[model samples]
Target: MVRKPVVSGMFYEDNADKLSSQIEDSFHSEFGPGKLPSKKRTREIFGVISPHAGYQFSGPGAAWAYREIAESRPADTYVMLGISHSGFPSCTSLEDWETPLGTVKVDKAFQAAFMERSGLKQDETAHSQEHSIEVQLPFLQFVNKEYKDQLKIAPIIISEEQRCKEIALSIAETIKQTGKKAVIIASSDFTHYGMNYGFFPFQDNVRENMHNLDKGAIEHIKSLDADKFMGYIDDTGATICGRLPVAAAISACRILGAKKAKMLQYYTSGDITHDYSSAVGYGSLVIE
Candidate 1:
């Protein structure tokens, strides 16, 4: 058995029934469940960008992607690549991530192959308390009920730009070799809007500016232009914490024949709290 849920009571409801209701409520409240578009409208998801903030702030944005993933034929595994805030040389850390819904077993066979091919060591410290990876679990549980029993996940915490690309490419290679349809999620929040994030150029206009930047970022992803993506961040100083993950996802998606990237939803914490002075950006995308 996998490790039990560690962040249920704190990050989300600890009670199973309450958690289920809340997750479903979140999905409907954020994006109307009744009006969910047909799966044919969106392309297959090779990778998606989700936020890592507390559920109160980013859960809705996270739900957009999770709901979409759930509607599609369920996958046998999920590969999550998250950002690392701790100071350390970049490496892909591994662990069996848990949630109150149930534990998502790690794919040991795939993990062993990934390590042998990528030369990245298995470091528990990378995932011990990283919120980026943990924040995506509840959405997974809500989207896939069989997650606990049938689905497995490979959790990798990335700390450096080069390492992020290396790991992403290695995983793409692994997927191709294994002939498995796996969903990859890159958890990150967009520009942190205020003095707290050190990116207050827009002042009260931060919210408007962030929406524009997010649009531009989504466009770059559509082109699968890694150089353009990195350049976009460099040029804007946009403050996206998942820069590497975004870039790598673009690269991997392009190789997989993803022709277009559609922005499913984009919003800031201010949308929820109405406090524009300081906020975080959240966006969800689907690559077809």
Candidate 2:
């Protein structure tokens, strides 16, 4: 079964040529303020954090991370931990995902091993309408175009924090046991502020406050402290949509012997729209 994209033409371009062009543009586009970390191609990246939003809004930020993955030469499979935006509970899908670029085959062998180790059930409906995972496919498609045949995906929907850690550990064990090289992609977006998300935590300096809050969370990620990352979100009531997914990826990376992380880029939607009244933050990071 092929899982058709639900967000194409809405969150990103639907036409194949247009989508490819848009992604290429994002790669060359100038990222927001602050000097981006220098891309080190020799270091092996264990995982990455990419934002899930409209391509125009967060594409440039995401490109920084994907560019690193492409430059480093990724493994055969990618374990994508995405938030359940469809309000569904946690689940995993074992179906090929169809994007405008092409169809990405699901790693059924890896999925089966993961399920046996993690005891997570396969629920196709859980991924039916979710946009978080769908939004990241184009980036992967563009980066792995040369090795598309070798690239397979294991898409998992993350919900609860504790459950995410447990599943992540299982994922690590499976990778170790199978001896299959895989990279984890944690699909997430930072703080969603203002009345739109009903998560306005500050009255003054909203933009700066949002950046600080997101930076604090990013620091935890940089340290590979999954517990501290989740705790920071709870303590500050930061409206990070994919906190669980990020925590899961961090924990998994830690188990996989990842010791360092670097922030690639950070920006908010407000920077583009010039409307600080309602904003959503986006960030990219690479864990190695």
Q: What is the TM-score of each candidate against the true structure?
A: 0.90, 0.95
Q: Candidate 2, which segments miss by more than 4 Å at Cα?
A: 32-43
Which candidate leads in lDDT? 2
> Residue 181 CA error for candidate 1 (Å)?
1.6
The Cα error of candidate 2 at residue 103, in Å, is: 0.5
User: How many residue-pair clashes does candidate 1 contain?
Assistant: 0
- lDDT of candidate 1 vs native? 0.72
Name the weakest run of 10 consecutive residues (lDDT summed) in model 2. Answer: 32-41
The per-residue C-alpha lDDT of model 1 at residue 46 equals: 73
Error of 2 at 111 (Å): 0.4
Candidate 2 residue-wise lDDT, 1-288, digit = tens: 899999999999999999998887787776732233244445578989999999999889889878877777568789999988768878899999999999999999999999999888899999989998899888998888878887799999988766877888988998897788888999999999999899987889888898999999999999999889889988999998999988889899999999978998998999878888999999999999
Model 1 stretches with alpha carbons more than 4 Å out: 1-7, 30-43, 92-94
